[model samples]
Target chain A: MAEKHINARGLQCPGPIVQIFKEAQNCAAGDILCVEVTDQGFKKDIAAWCKKTKNELLSLEEEGGVIKARIKKG
Target chain B: MSENKKTIIVFSGDLDKAMASFIIANGAAAMGNEVSMFFTFWGLNILRKPEKIRTRKSFMEAMFGWMMPRGAGKLGLSKMNFGGIGAIMMKSIMKQKKVNTIQELIESARALGVKMIACTMSMDVMGFKEEELIDGLEFAGVATYLGEADEANVNLFI
Candidate 1:
């Protein structure tokens, strides 16, 4: 499967999630989407989004106020 | 009636409230939920067109139309607006934070297939013509909103 990166860093609230959703629409099943965000709410939001969307949260990490996530499309 | 359906009644006209409605709608829609927003009362102002649309109306209707802010750009915040300066400051902060503006949020919600319904009763009371509001909106009444809400698991009044 192919992997795509979404630079959602600096976006706030739903901005990062919406960007990931928009990008995910173009990806095939099993494709991985990597996203980075600076929004403090993203950690909880991303987990909830993955659960609701049935996507696999491969990895999630935070450093220096930037949170990164890898999601495998379901 | 799908389990993954949401309905929001946008009752207030404040910019902050409008943004909140759109943010939730967009978030739910991104998570693969169907979302519907009903605009009524002062919330109808959020859908108004920015440009002046010439339409014949009664004196009170004309006055109401003249007094209300036109479109998303003109809406003021619900609190600490400071005679509109707060809205300007908020917009600047959102820009700095790379947050989407209400205009962008509305566009994103539309693109995500979120249903936007404008209340006909409110339109009549407010003297707003169909052409006076932004495009891509469904004109309906409370019954329609109720019908949508009945099928939705989450119903919020903003």
Candidate 2:
């Protein structure tokens, strides 16, 4: 399985999600993407995006004020 | 599930409002929804060229062009403008937060296939030249906007 990492640490709401969407374009159906972000709004945004896009959100974690979301492209 | 179209009438040219409108447009487009934005009156200023294009125009037309904000980058805040300083401060905050600027958001929306329609009536009334606006815009009248709005599942007047 392929994996991708997106450093969205400094990005705000929708910026990180937009970046994830852009990156997800090149990935295969089962590829895993890890997005690192600092925006608190992303907690809900990513979940909603994955739900809308029919992707699988594997995990969401926060560490030292940074949020990381692991998603599997569907 | 079939109601997936979103149409927005962008009536304000203020930076913050424009940013909000574009953010919504982009988000909707990202979710595979059909998005259309109609620019009217002051909203047309968001699509103007950043630099003066030096097009030949009548004196009144020239004055109108000079008085309006040149482009997205030059737009002022809708509130607490503080003589243009507020816009500058807002830009700084956006940068620090890594939020896309209004210009960047517009580009993203376009790239996401959002239909950007410029109101010809507003353009004529506001003295905006066809060549002075950005590329890739579809020009139409109120009928077209109304048609799109009528079918859109989510219609907004901003």
Candidate 3:
């Protein structure tokens, strides 16, 4: 499966999620999306979004101020 | 699985409020939720056409239409506006922050298939004809908004 990297840094609420959602739409069912966001609120938002969209969250971690998440599309 | 529905009543015409409502609507729609935004009262200004359209109006209607800000681009902030300067500053900050403007958000929401409904009663009160507003909007009354809200899991009044 192909993998995509999304840099959603410097965006506020809904920006990061919107970017991820838009990118995910162009990907195949089994593709992987690695998203990096600077919005602190995105930590919880991403989990909730992944749950609602039925995407599998591979890992979520924070390095410095950026939050990184890997999600496999379901 | 059944799709979730969201209904938002956009009652405020302030730039910040409009942005908030659109942001929520766009986010919900992107998450595969069916989202509907009902524009009523002052909120109808968000859907107004920037360019003046030739429409017959009474003296009072013409005055009201003239006084109200036309379209999304002319909207002002609800607080600390300093007579529109705050709105200009806010737009600059939004640009620097790389955040989408209200126009872009509305376009994105439309692209995401979010339903936008303008309140017929408000249009009547405001003397706004269909041609006076932006295109791609469904005109309806409160009953229609209530019906949409009834099926929605989340209902918000902004």
Candidate 4:
């Protein structure tokens, strides 16, 4: 199953990060989280987090004015 | 032990940039990671009381001239020159769209245990008294900031 949430589209940089931090806490080992953001600064940032944490980024896409990211817990 | 912390050394008071620094530090802290913000020079202005803000705001404010003090208009990035009007308009739009104020965000960061440090040198230079700043700010020197920066998983200068 997939859990999707809208986060920090127009909020700001760390807004999305704050959402990711919270989600990472409740997530199971295999749970999927979709983060929708519009901050361009987060493109490299979220990728860096995935690489560092060993989590799997299932997908990253942009629709309209939002950056949608899907990540599966490691 | 928690994950390696992220340390940000902020030298500018530009609202947008400082807000970005605070957001990163607070985000990292909320994630069970340590976070520190080193405020230097113009960046220290954010910590000052509302009175000082008005004095600075008159000259530095880049957006909506009549907004409240301690508002986003006083931030370093949102200043009146170096692309002032556009940045101000964007900030006004962001505010209209429900972006949280910098002060509110700072409070959230503090609640999450993000460390806030103001530079002693900068304070001395600015001639700010302890009573002039908001409560609960930690003051220190470059060495202190550097020590934390050394152990940081991510170090940012904003």
Candidate 5:
């Protein structure tokens, strides 16, 4: 289970990613964060952010219209 | 590859253009890139305070301030301004689309540590007071902008 959950659905490009950046800061090392977004553009953006911030992207899944990303803080 | 460095010169005070600048800046900063934005000419209007603040200035300077948009919220559209109503419609549409507003984008850029610089020459020419602009800004000349742009991996003028 994710230690923190972020509901960023319906947000446009960059908004969802910004929210993830802010929330990820509060997560301790080894804590997992789950982000829910509606924009497909976030797929690439989240991957880049995770790599830049040194976080681990465990999984990214899409269901219906929602995209869920699970990231482990590093 | 080496770390990315992005620098932008904001020369337009239009709402859409300002929005674009912030969006790019925030994205670059989020990706661990060093981002710098230099506001000059009409672009300085984007940094003006929202409320009307009376500052002692020459008549010409006061007129310039009065005529320009107060802040990001008051900037007109570059094209199809439609007497300023177009800007209002655009703001509404952005809200409906769940896009970050220009003001929100500016805040995000600041939070992400994007360097905000005001062109000293432009400020003098436009008769803008230091107090009239937003806080957390570095004042410099064109040389300063060039210095940063020279080393930036991505340089843009908007």
Candidate 6:
């Protein structure tokens, strides 16, 4: 499976979420999506998204002023 | 529920209430929800032309009301009075946290296609001229809002 990358740093709340949805549309099963966001809003937002959409958050970690999250499309 | 495809209605225009509108609308829009912020009555004031809507009292309040950004932005907790000193406290916190202004959030929402509709009946009642509002705003009546609202699983009033 291939992993898609999204750099959403400096973008606020729904910005990352909107873009991620747009990006995920182009991906297929077994594909991985990694997003780099700045803070808590993304974590809250993405978590809820994953829950509702049935996607899986494979990994979430913080590094260098960025919050990294990965989701594997189920 | 379809992720990021919910609809929300914002019925308030107070500074604090507007903040709730901004946070909620943006929050929902972030979830990939096709958000529609049906701004009616006072809510339409946010899209008012920058120059036409001027503040009368509270210079500091006016400055924050005017300078910080208008409409959805004027709604921030910082710009609002959560309490006597709450506005001030929130402003400081926002400055420290680097959160986007309500205007910026609205702009971002538009960029993401978070359809924003201004209520026609409300505007008429309020005597707001078309030119006084921001560009790219979709104008519609109650029925229009309802058509979309009916399709949405999530609906809210603020």
The top-ranked prediction according to lDDT is 1
Q: What is the DockQ of candidate 1?
A: 0.80
Candidate 1 yields a Cα-based lDDT of 0.94
Better of 3 and 6 by TM-score: 3
Q: Model 6, stretches more than 4 Å misplaced? A: A1-19, A22-31, A36-38, A41-44, A62-67, B1-5, B53-89
Q: Which wins on TM-score, candidate 2 or candidate 6?
A: 2
iRMSD per prediction, in order: 1.1, 1.4, 1.7, 2.7, 1.5, 2.8
lDDT of 3 by residue, B25-124 (tens): 9899878799999999999999999999989999989998999989999999999889999999999999998788999999989988999999999999
Error of 1 at A7 (Å): 0.7
Query: Of the candidates numbered 2 and 5, which has the greater lDDT value?
Result: 2
Score candidate 4 by TM-score against the native. Answer: 0.68
DockQ for each numbered candidate: 0.80, 0.63, 0.62, 0.34, 0.64, 0.41
- Highest TM-score model number: 1
Give a tens-digit lDDT track for model 1, residues B1-158: 77799999999999999999999999999988999999999999999999999998899998999998899899999999999999999999888878799999999999999999999999999899999999999999989999999999999999
TM-score of every prediction relative to native? 0.97, 0.93, 0.93, 0.68, 0.91, 0.72
Across residues A1-74, which tens digit of lDDT does each residue of candidate 2 receive?
89999998887666777788888989999999998999898999889999988899999999999999999999
**C-alpha lDDT of residue B41 in model 1:** 93
Ranking by lDDT: 1, 3, 2, 5, 4, 6
Task: Report how far off residue A68 is in candidate 4 (Å).
Answer: 3.8
Tell me the deviation in Å of residue B9 in model 3. 0.4
Question: What is candidate 5's CAPRI-style docking category based on DockQ?
Answer: medium
**Candidate 5 residues B56-114, lDDT tens each?**
88999888888889988899999988999998898888889888999889999999899
CAPRI classification of candidate 3: medium
Rank candidates by DockQ, best first. Answer: 1, 5, 2, 3, 6, 4
Worst 10 residues of 3 chain B by lDDT: B1-10
